[model samples]
Target: MKPLDTAILLAGVPLASPVTLLSGCVGFCEDLARMEGFDFSAVGAIFLKGTTLQARQGNRPPRVVETQGGMLNAIGLQNPGARHVVDHILPTIQHLPTRFFANIAGSTVAEYGEVARIFDDSPVDGIEINISCPNVKEGGAAFGSDPKVAAHVVETVKRVTSKPVITKLSPNVTDITRVAQAVIDAGTDAISAINTLMGMAIDLEKRRPVLGNGQGGLSGPAIKPVALLQVWRIHQIAGPRGIPIVGQGGITTARDAMEFMVAGATAIGLGTALFRNPLGAREVLDGMVAWGQRLGVANFHEIRGTLNQP
Candidate 1:
């Protein structure tokens, strides 16, 4: 297992801890950065919500549905738009201590590149191409499920900017590693495995889908076991190629972070847990650091995949 450390380095940025915040709104991201003074420093980085060139209203009401494994969301990448993010959000963190990560989504290659260009000059540390979102019209799954389309999105965004690109992949596919390899081939700097599992719930009384969209991405503790499996599997794939892995999915405690590190994750992201408790990120980081110290683990990287060595 990897040893614990008080700080994690991401794309060369010194994050006080390996716990990163996953969000979708500019205002929330800025506020999170501002909260660092109160020990928000453990935050490895922040992943902005899905973005587009034009503002979107997202899906209709009842977009969130609960399932046996996790909750599904049909947020649809609602945001104030790319230009607004640059104008309004970039300034809020001009002097913040951590790295800024942007999550982007698009219906076409041009839209993806355009949004990538918008963040090209900002203080953001990296970009996460959201290839896992289900396509609204295309019969195929999200771009990430289709290697050809996934590679194209990675290559398209790579053409516009030099910032480290993190391609977020979905677990709904048959072969996640294959999808991951395709994006890596196109030049993404890192990979975030297992976005949210696909799931749905129904309203018994209404005899309709619980969520307005019928299906939503499932997340939380229910999926942690699967998330760990995916992270461990992807770590194996990335090892031979020297690519770093950002572990995410159902992380709610420090032990959870340790599990991923032992399985082979460079850093980690805290998702749905953030909504249940804003302080959840800080708490988990603190616990992980303590556990590492207790185990005499000095650096998390050391624990990365230590359990799998021959």
Candidate 2:
């Protein structure tokens, strides 16, 4: 099938493909561009690293640890801040082939609004409100765990930005659908489900946690099942409302992406897979095309929510 035939729209932005680079992975799309044979146009959209109100030093050493079938990270949303991103990063990446999106995070509702406003005036095609960074102490997952707070964040950011606002939900919540509904009601253009689940590793030798922060967010294939369930649950609520879901976590191959699509994810995000292969998105897209051809599927939309229920 043609590339355009596989295209999907997210929050009114037409992506060349349904594959999106997850936030905090691509680092503003520069690092991936430097890799040999990496192509920006291969995917639908690129979500830059998590950007906060001010520059942060991030957590101490041992922020990332490899786990069975997945990895854990507590990067602490380290970023160059919103203003620096608007002034330096966005301009440099304006010519990329795909749509550009900003991943905004803040410690307070006002901070979220301010960051959203900064990116709204910039050249990004959309804004993803990252209310689910598990490593932080105050803002990230703390607000996401509560439906009211998540709704308030969505509402606050929506009021300040004209750009599409996609809310990233935490998997740690008891009832993800409640949070999803709250954000959708608050004017979120789309929903990105199943951010890294909170977890930790221990150093047997040192008798301490592997991560300096004592805990970190677990990601990679290990969370694929959980991600799928969350996506499906949220889709049951948001799909009828015309709000798309960005299903992510543990997606490394075409089969993984298809599983998410079948589970109701309108878009698939590439995160931990990038660490294994910088050109992972291209491979996943190519694999998806091959799978589409084999399955006689004309477009990705046909595979979305095709899961069989008993």
Candidate 3:
């Protein structure tokens, strides 16, 4: 049997594998590097935590809560600002084997552009615009929820940066495809589908909200079905244009990752799953290789977006 090739050019960026460590799950790649038995060369890319133009204190405590099949997080895109990241933090992780992409967010369109500009001069291989952070009270899901506004944000970033830009879409929207098309038309190189779903939990005893923020983004196995559909929907728009989709949202196992690929994800993102299993990336890659060998396929691209209708 031929060896399975688990590599591809995501948005024209060469990657070692299709398993990309999602933003927020891996804090600036430093934490993951310190973990035992974790191989940097085994993964494709790492999207650093969401960074803004100015430092943010984030929301109050009680930010994360465990639920039935997943967890709710209102971390509010906490980070030490873009300048600090580009100057101090990025230098420390430059020796990591894999590619690093900056996950950028802001309270306004201009702020998004400024942050992108800051990262454009850094060592980051790419930039992912976080227009869909539901935990934040301003500029996160707000910019992503509107097609025109989302396009504006993408265009703004594109104007300032020479690096490839990937627009992360929000699942909270009524029609995600509309936003996907809008960003693609605005010169986005790739798409990251289904950021997170808006959800809330109440302190039944106290009669107040469980998280510090009234609402938070729900992730884990609970949102897999929704994430799959959204990825497929966005793929219909991105696939034809030759734009890659970074499918993420409840991918915890190899099967889940394969399902996302069948649904049209060019590369799979492992987010919430990392919280429970830090070494899940290796397991997922191993499983994918085994499945590929069993199917007699030399590469995963052969099976990507091959789902059939009933």
User: Per-candidate TM vs. native?
Assistant: 0.92, 0.95, 0.97
Q: Cα deviation in Å at residue 156, candidate 1?
A: 1.1
Candidate 3 Cα misplacement greater than 4 A, ranges: 133-141
> Can you write out model 2's per-residue Cα lDDT over 1-310, one digit (the tens) per residue?
3432678888898888999989988888876665666677678898999999899889998899999999999999889999999999887878777888899988888889999999999999999988874324453458888898889999999999899989999998899999999999999999998899999899999999999999999999899989988998898988899999999999999989988998888899999998888778888988888888877887888888888986
Clashes of each: 8, 2, 0
Question: Cα lDDT of all candidates, in order?
Answer: 0.79, 0.88, 0.90
- Report the error of model 2 at residue 76, Å: 0.4
How many residue pairs in model 2 have overlapping backbones?
2
Give per-residue CA lDDT, model 1, range 234-271, as digits (tens): 87778677777888888888898889888878888888
Give the clash count for model 1.
Answer: 8
Q: What are the C-alpha RMSDs, in order, of all predicted structures?
A: 2.7, 2.1, 1.8
Q: Write the per-residue lDDT of candidate 3 for residues 22-107, one digit (tens) a residue.
A: 99999888877676767876689999999999888888989999888999999988899999999999998888889999999988
**Residue pairs in candidate 3 whose N, alpha carbon or C atoms collide under 3 angstroms:** none
